[model samples]
Target: MIHRRSGSVGAGAVDGGAGWDGVEPQDYDDPSLGGVRKHELIGEAEGARQYRMRYFEVPPGGRTARERHPHDHGVMIVSGRARVTLGSETHEVGEGDVVYVAGDELHCFEALGDEPLGFVCVVGPRSAS
Candidate 1:
């Protein structure tokens, strides 16, 4: 069976590709997080037990908490640019680029340029770190 969900272009959203239908805009556990939201795209309700797919949009200059978890995650850059911090290293990424964060690896993402950094991430059910 196919569990399909559609997302529309967000109004004033950077690159117009970061909003999802029926998905609520939620914030992460970061103090410095600028105006942003995370959308859950798929999960157990959709029969995905091993992993969960989620989308996040960080406004320009926004950043995620530099934290780590026991579960690994993979992120696919879907829009805009980002300055990603992995451990003690940093890198610039854009659309179509993929990022992998191993279990317990210190990681963070900061929006670059004038656009919101949006990405779709597939991760273990524990958390999106």
Candidate 2:
């Protein structure tokens, strides 16, 4: 089954290309992830109660921080090519490639092509307690 969200932003918007109106690309909070920017597509502001969707862009020769989290992640490559490291295994991914990161698994994404590597990721809300 296909799931879709509609509103002022997200997949419902009529904007062309990978970007949406009102969404601004921001630098990755972690400095270790070089030349990475993030655009939040869906989250608490969108009234989503379960998950948040985000788009990440890594410039050529850049990579995401190598870290592990307790929350699982669903990632899909939307543009360019990347070298994704899941645990100890690293694999090359291109457009339309899907990646599943299990809870507490070590993972990172590196842009391998001249253009920016863009990908969308869905993640569950973090527990407050």
Candidate 3:
């Protein structure tokens, strides 16, 4: 994964003046697998760090399989809603809500609204397995 900086302007839209540049939105290809699209924010960070943002158009009854990551992941809801199941605990996430996933924890995500659910995902450096 190539670690790409979000450019000058970020989510907070800070003003860096003259040379300030904004991060361009990149699209993820997944037309064959529903309408799931991922826009990577920060691919590879300096040293041991990684960050990414993803958008999903999950269909009704659609759900992500249980998966584990070697790094701690954090997610912030931007639009719509979702039912995130982390182990035996399930919670609803909506706009302005942030969810954190512990490293190596079993987790699953599901769309909880009639429309597609979109969110930003940020992950830390991957720990040795």
59 Cα displacement, candidate 3 (Å)? 4.7
TM, every model? 0.83, 0.81, 0.62
Off-target runs (Cα >4 Å) in candidate 3 are 1-33, 45-61, 126-129
**Against the correct fold, how does model 3 do in TM-score?**
0.62
Candidate with better TM-score, 2 vs 3: 2
Q: Rate the local accuracy (lDDT) of all candidates.
A: 0.78, 0.76, 0.56
Residue pairs clashing in model 3 are 3-44
Across residues 1-129, which tens digit of lDDT does each residue of candidate 3 receive? 343433332222112211112333333343444534454445443233444444333443445556777778788776566899887899988778999999878887776646556667777644552
What's each prediction's clash count? 0, 0, 1
Q: Sort the predicted structures by TM-score, highest score first.
A: 1, 2, 3
Write model 1 residue lDDT over 1-129, tens digit each, in one string: 443445443234644545556666677656467576787778766777789888888888888888888898899988888999999999999988999998999999898888778888888975544
Model 1 Cα shift for residue 78 (angstroms):
0.5
For residue 22, give model 1's deviation from the true position in Å. Answer: 2.5
Q: What is the lDDT of residue 24 in candidate 3?
A: 38
Better of 1 and 3 by lDDT: 1
